[model samples]
Target: MGTTQLETVPEPKYWHLRTVLSNALDSEFEVGEILPNERELAARFGVARATLRQALEQLELEGRLQRRRGVGTTVAPPRVGVEVNPTRHSWPGAPGDAWQTEGCAEDVPPAVVGRALGRGDEKVYTVHRVRTVHGQPVATELLYVPPASVPGLSGIAGLETDAGVARGRAVLRELQRLELGGQERTVELGSARAEDAKRLDRLPGAPVLVLTTRYLAAGGTAAVAVSTYRADTCRLTFGESAGTGLLAAG
Candidate 1:
């Protein structure tokens, strides 16, 4: 019996390192599991620290690695899809299901929000949240709702947990009571704020996708939620499937 020697193939330093790390993560890591520090990992890979850091940065943008401050880098999970579907009106939860809520004093809203709400300097409920993916922060969302539009809401009842989805559910529970009429959405380029950048582990002023939508209920404007999702690591899915019409040209 004899053994045959196999040929070895190599690519760019960073590319090979990235592949090695990505495969290791897929096979050996669980969501929220932190990887060894850069210095250690680079030493293990026999590559320069800069090369390893570049690879890690790419993986992080791809939603595979999560970098934290003071803490360390960890494996990031897949991004959750929170759709803005016309078919569904509310989320899964009780009247009070959000992670937490604060009674924001009434104040004048931004110009864009005022137009969406179709009111002038009206008081509204402002809710903010930091959504995490794979235990790493990803995005920040702000929800502004006119108090009069959401009737019978004495307080934010179910928002206390650290879970962002729970908080969204709580808001939906309160929102469902009003008849959902129509809605509008817009997408624009935005720079990350200091707070959001801190959570997302990106430099301040990093590019992001800003989705501003107004929720209309009971033939009147209810609230507007401005959600900022990382453009590099996120995809927005909207509308129905695309199909060729019978009358269309091939």
Candidate 2:
């Protein structure tokens, strides 16, 4: 590849470099290919290391690159397509569901979740789950089910023990008994919280897509789930055939 010095343009230097790098990624690099070191990249572009760093950071945020600890920087795989259409509704943990239950605990949820449940300050069963694609953790969820929703769940046991997994499974099983009237969902961009960041292997305050779902049954909200997905690895889709060719544009 030939070197191209950056021209003096009104746009920010880093922004211009980002475009140039993006084009090169399209024409030259394959997915998961390791990038040249910062010094080499800077010299090749005839820009300072600071400018090159800024450009690289921008690309990572846009999902064009990944900066893995100890592995160096490489082109990122295409974002996974996650279906978010409200019309396609099913209770979590259904046979075809992709999430794996991690644990369950009874706790007073955040104010936003409490409001969604319409049970202010009341304790609910919070089921923790992780969603992975190709063995890579991409999302984590906090599913809040009111005690009233899962009346059959018994045996108040330790939540951190092996029993916790059983408890989470029981809650999900009980939920399937109810008649699912419908569900409402909302998607928004948010910063990763400390807990969610750790699970997704991202730094706290990294960009994430927050998907909040309210499962309605018996004329009330049966459960509320707040799922945080790594924005760099996911693309929210709203169709029956979601996630197909999500990265085709790249």
Instruction: Report the lDDT tens digits of candidate 2 across residue range 172-213.
Output: 998998999998888999999999999998999999999999
Q: Each candidate's TM vs. the true structure? A: 0.71, 0.82
The TM-score of predicted model 1 comes to 0.71
> What TM-score should be assigned to candidate 2?
0.82
C-alpha lDDT values of all predictions: 0.63, 0.85
Those runs of model 1 whose alpha carbons end farther than 4 Å from true positions after fitting are 1-11, 82-87, 91-103, 133-135, 151-174, 198-202, 239-250
- Where is the poorest 10-residue window by lDDT in model 2? 154-163
Give me the overall lDDT of model 2: 0.85
